[model samples]
Target chain A: MFEVRIHSRGGQGGVTAARLLALAAVRDGKYATAFPFYGAERRGAPVVSFVRIDDAPIRISSQIKKPDLVIVLDPSVMDVVDVLQGLKPGGRVLLNARERRDMKGYPTFTVDLTGIALREKLEVAGSPILNTPVLGALAKMGIVTMESAKSAITEMFSDPRNVSAAEAAYRELVA
Target chain B: MLTVATGNKAVAAAVKEAAPAVVAAYPITPQTEIVEQIAEYVSSGELKSQYIPVESEHSAMAACIGASVTGARTFTATSSHGLHYMHEMVNWAAGARLPIVMANVNRALGPGWNIWAEHTDAFQERDSGWLQVYVGSVQEAFDAVLMAFCIAEDERVLLPVMVNLDGFLLSHTMQPLEIEKAGDFIPPLHLPHAIDPQNPCGYGTLTGPDDYFRLRWDIERSMRDAVDVIRGTQERFARRFGRKYGMVDEYRCDDAEVVIVAAGTLGREAEVAVDLLRDEGTRAGSMRIRWFRPFPRLDLSGRDVVVIDRDYSFGFGGVLAKSIAATEGARPFSVIAGLGGQEVTYEDIAGFVRNRQPGRELWFGVNGDV
Candidate 1:
């Protein structure tokens, strides 16, 4: 089984990214589940969402304490929350940042998701929606194919720009 | 075919398949999406029903009861404070013996204001004469809601059924759910004591000592008879859908010595814990009590039982553990966990089994000792 924990601010589409990832995995013929953990309904607050994928039915319902992968949609969340708290050894961290920073002991991948969102003009009320682009960079990890990710994004947003943004980030992802 | 959907969406899908005559909608967190989807189905002409957007939960249920009395198949959904707000109507819906089905997203009630998953919201209405079924999976949530209508509308058990699922845990969690079309498996609802204007009948008027006692006894008798109705309905549902569910789902319990008892999503976690314990060479199992209203008698004759409850009953022990102790004649080690949606992992569950004091109440993951 593969588990992922996503960190981002509310209204930034972290929950949507988790759902899209699960959808893509399921479309790829794998069992998947996704959910978010949030108390307040306000925007700009820290939000956490999770995704689990496996070949067989996933039975455990608890939150992902030890995630095989962690995706940070907003770098500012790093200061407020421990996004790497339960990251397993050999697990990878995908960040939506302009420049890569040292993540202590884990391998990190970087993508300018905000820049990609801006390039693709994916914004809602003046905030760049970075979920799709970050998911695109996550697709580089090979857990889900880029084509499946694009299909899932299209299934959710039904917009050509979302598919384009995901394709752009999938090509420009850097380690 | 299997499609991925949230638990709330699965419930809305099942309700749409049931094709109720009326749906009373009031929005609440985690539960809001269920009714919102139902409203969309009505607006899109996917489901033909009278959709009433009420002001509050009380009015939502009140409208369902009103519609149900006219022999209409009715449905509603609520959570946490919303369910508490509908306390009076909840009792009235059952006391009037209306065959109404409601989806209750179990959430923590608070002075501190929490909206996480907890069972206190539904446990408070235990004596309100409603048949409560707590579901663990998104698929089960859909199946249980479909079965609830059949059980409640039976001639022998004309009481309301509250289908409870953990808020956000099962409510918002996505899973591969197989939705069956409500065909001959669930027949049209026929209320034997409906308020018929053509027959000129009086309904729910004041009852004196001469008749009130007998009415209450009748409700109890129906509750007792509901156990068999639920089993038979589930059996018929399985025969049609090819998926069988029990009043209590047992996992790896055949040759085990230590068993963990849980409800809702915690039961799924306990099943994982049982596997982990077995890998470590400990004989452990998990039992998920699905129907809490007509509490099924479990055979825990020779097993060390550990009860994990998400809600506490203040003076008494864990509600499920106490019920088991009263019925099964065995004192269990009670553990109160997952209150207000505090994270309880399978590792913590295995630890509970290794460090349990029989016949004692242990509050797991609390700050201070009790």
Candidate 2:
């Protein structure tokens, strides 16, 4: 089973990204489950969402304690929360950051997801929605293909620019 | 066709397939998506039903009862405080012999305000005369909701059925669900005691001690009879859909000396713990009690039974442990765990098995005394 944990603030589409990832995996003929750790239901609160993908049925319903990959949608969240708390050894980090930061362990991929969202004009009420672009970065990990991710984004969001944002992030992802 | 869906969406899809005559809508966290989807179905003409927008959860159940009395197949969904708000009507729906089906997303009832998965909300309604079935998976949530209507509408069991799923655990968690058309298995609902305008008879009228006692007995008799009706319904569903469910789902229980008994998602996790224990040569098994209402008879005769409950009864103990001990007459190693959606991993359950002792209630992961 491949478990991925996504960290972001509320109203930033963290849960949407998790669901899109699961839907993409399902579209690709694999079993997947996505759910959010619902804390305070207000905007700007730190939120976490999880996705589990596997060949067989995923049975365990507990939160992802040891995630195979961690996707951080908001770079500022790193100061407040431990985004890499339960990352397994040799696991990868997909960060929506401006610059690549060297970590002792694990392969880290940094993408300017906010910049990409701004460039693509993917903003809701002036705040850049970075989850879609972060999902594109997540696709680079090979857990879900870029094509499947784009299709899922299109299926979930009616706006055409969201697909463009995902595609752009998929191309602009850097390690 | 198989599709990826959260438990809430699966339930809404199942309800749509059932195509109830009326659906009362009141939004609550983890449960809101269900009624939201149902409302969408109703609005889009996918499901031809009357969607009653109620102000509160209490009114939701009240509306269900009102619609159900006219012999309409009714459905509703609620969670946590919402379930508590509908507490009075919950009992009324059952006592009135209305075949109402409700999806209850089990959540923690709070003074501190929590919306996480917990069984306390559902467990509080144990005596309300509702046939309760706690489901573990998104698929089971859909299947149980479909089967609930059949069981409740049966002449032998004209009681409301509460399909309980863990809030945000099974409720919000997505999975691949294989949904069968409800018309294939469930026939049109037939309420024997429905109010007919032509008959001009009174319903739920005041009864003296003599008549009231018999009415209560009748409900009890029907509740007991519901056990067989539920099994038969599930058997027919299996034949049609090729998926079978039981009142109690046993996993690796045969030839095992130690067993962990649980309900909902905890039981699913315990199965993983059982496999891990067996790998280390410990004879362990997991028993998932599906139907909490009928409380299926379990054989823990020679096995060291461990009861893991997500809800407690304050003064007594874990609700499941008490129920099991009442029926099986064996003092189980009771572990109260996962209240307010506290994370309980399979490894935590394995630790419970390793240090289990009989005749004591151990609150798993509790910091200090009691």
Candidate 3:
């Protein structure tokens, strides 16, 4: 089972991102699970969400320490937290920024999600979160399918507003 | 008899056929319709069982465990947060080896709060030693509930089974399902329930550290062995209902040089991609897993494997790929994609097939800007 660890501030959609990831897997007919570990479980606190994706049933049950893939949704998390602590030697890191990883440790890519989210109109009260836009980049980058990501978002939001916003974010990211 | 049915309705049919003596549940998102249908049966007197409509999900599973211990086949259903609220009871039921069966209309858990389908509910409960199964189409969800009962109640494997349903996909989505007649479903799997005066015994014993490990080991062993039962039970269900469910569903993979792995609803989408790829002469294949608990590794070997994981493992990527990697002596190329409910596309999948590695992981579709 492949575990994905996401780092974001509380309310930055880390947990939402995790669930969306699982829902996307569901859309693709893959056995997937997502959860998060937060100290305060409130807004603004640093947050981390975990996802286990597999073609088979998952058995290991522990907070993932070493991640095969680490996604830093919020750039500030890179400053305050150790995002690279437990990365596998050759693991790839996806960051939400315009600048690629200049730090020495691992392979990284920087996609300007705020720019995509703004174009896609996927903002909550003027705050353009990077989740869906990043998803779009992942799709273009040849990871999972865009349909599965869309399905996951559809599965996530009951509000058409949220769904449409996610779609816009996707379009903007791709655009 | 065989008739077109929705996924939730299929689960209800399976529960009815299992004929649990006492079924307790509270209506919650996606999972509500299940109890609604079963309640109809109870009211119509078509089924003989105590249908307890409790106030909450915790009470629902609580009633189920109490009934099971008292020698009644017990069942219930819930969604995301509801499952989280009653998460403790899930472990209690399985730890007690109560053999309870429930359907989770897989929903997203809340902080900002959402009522959509996702595996977070069951995913949070994976280590509880409860047998977990993910169904892709409504047909699989329909039959998984029946197969779950047969497997759960097997004296050799008396653990709770959570037949996870995609919230709206199966929970709210409509589909055609074939159900076996009552007689055909029951009889072979009637379980012995607890009765006050008839039989006296312990319900759930508090395990001390000494015997706890061994008891848990036994449970794990049963869980391991339950893999075969999962396949066997599905086979028997197919014999009766004319469908099939195995640990893994391999599509267009017989002659495939490159393979993509996933489970649940994504399997259908991946199937679409695989078909499109075949038409385009890519020779790509897909493997969707039905059983999430006993991860079937028999089919995963050295072939190029691209694991698409929706959930995130903090330190590593691709929980499924890692599980597969642990089994294989040689690792294939794997990519980590689809996180936080991101949409996965066919073109994205085609790209993976195009850049195919036998055993490597690629993490894509992410934003580095916040």
Candidate 4:
């Protein structure tokens, strides 16, 4: 079993990322669960979400604190918060940032999600959101299968053109 | 067959199916959708109900209470401060035993005023004499609504049932919700039968001090009886839809030396948290209290316990911890955390494992208040 936690502020696509990941896991014929921790019960506040995927039915009912993979939606969150509080020592960090060298220490990967959203002409930047971009980088880092992530994104978007653009951006981001 | 839906919609659809004659609710944030969907049903004539568009959350509850005593299947929805406004009738409906069903989208009660998911509002009404059942998903909300009607109308248990779900956590989320068609129950176990004025019976009648205590005690017995009725309803629901959500369901707590008991969304959150720890060799688990009124003693009969209360019982302490301490468990500790919508971070729960001691029930985080 593997757990993933996403650190994002209100309306930043943390919930969508977790759901997309879980749905992909489910599509992979593995058991999966995705849910968000409703924080401050408001927008623009730091919020966390949990996702679990396992070979067996996932039965434990709490949040994922010690996670194998932690994704941060906003780099500003790192300064105001210690997003790495409970990451497993050898775990991977995926950040939605433009630069990767500055995010030293642990194994880190970067993707400019805003840049991808802009390039793909995605709906309101907050809608198709950064989650899709981070998920693409998740594929590049070998955290989850790219094929699975691409397939998941294809299933998520309603328009064929956007789906094609997201897949293309995903490829461009990885390259 | 059960369909996936947000918990908010499930409860609303359940109320609609049961044929509640009078439906009233003001548009509060999270809970507003339940009544909004129900209003759609009424306007489309999909549900033969009187959709009363009220002006305030307080009146929504009051209208339900009053209509219920008139022997109408009554319903309403509210969250946080709106729930606070309806606090007075929370007891009024229960004392009157009006058998109304309300869906409280669990929101953090406020001084700072935030509208997110927490068990604060429902927890504040712990002793309100109303039956409270918290659901993990929208589907459970559907099951609870039907069970609430059956339990509340029972001759033994005539109390209102507040079927609660985490507001934004489950409310705004979309899912494929299965609603019972008009004749799905076969015999139509629909609500809102005649008030039987032919016999001129009295309802919401006055009770003097001499009879109040006995009446209250009897109400206690009725609540306990509801635990069994709730169990029976779960069984029936299973036969009808192959899903069983028991009152005191335990997961991985069997060989556990410690079990944290919680309700509503946190229980589900704890579910994900426990899975991660179990894989890492942590001997921790959780118990979800589906039925809050009866308190489900047998559920805690012999387990090392910690109570994760999302709300604080001012003047007292964490109700979950108190209930565990009062139940005489294996000297379990109570971890009071997540008060007033404060995030009970999953890490905060894991922290409970290494730091719990026996003597006093422990609170996870103490910020000014419990």
> Candidates sorted by TM-score, descending order?
1, 2, 4, 3
Local distance difference test scores for all models: 0.91, 0.89, 0.71, 0.72
- Tell the DockQ for candidate 4: 0.20
Off by over 4 Å in 2: B198-204, B367-370
Best by lDDT: 1
- Tens digits of per-residue lDDT for model 2, B220-336: 999999999999999998898888899999999999999999999999999989999999999999999999997799989999999999998988999999999999997898999
Candidate 1 lDDT tens digits, A17-127: 888899889888899999987677578888899999999878788889899999999989999899999899999899889999888779999899999999999898999
Angstrom error of the Cα, residue B257, model 2: value is 1.4
Candidate 3's C-alpha lDDT? 0.71
Per-residue lDDT, model 1, residue A118, is: 95
lDDT of 1: 0.91
Using TM-score as the yardstick, the better of models 1 and 3 is 1
Name the top TM-score candidate: 1
User: Between candidates 3 and 4, which one is better according to lDDT?
Assistant: 4
Best by DockQ: 1
**Candidate 2 lDDT over residue span A28-102, tens digit each:** 889999988866667888889999999987778888999998888887788899888989998998888888897
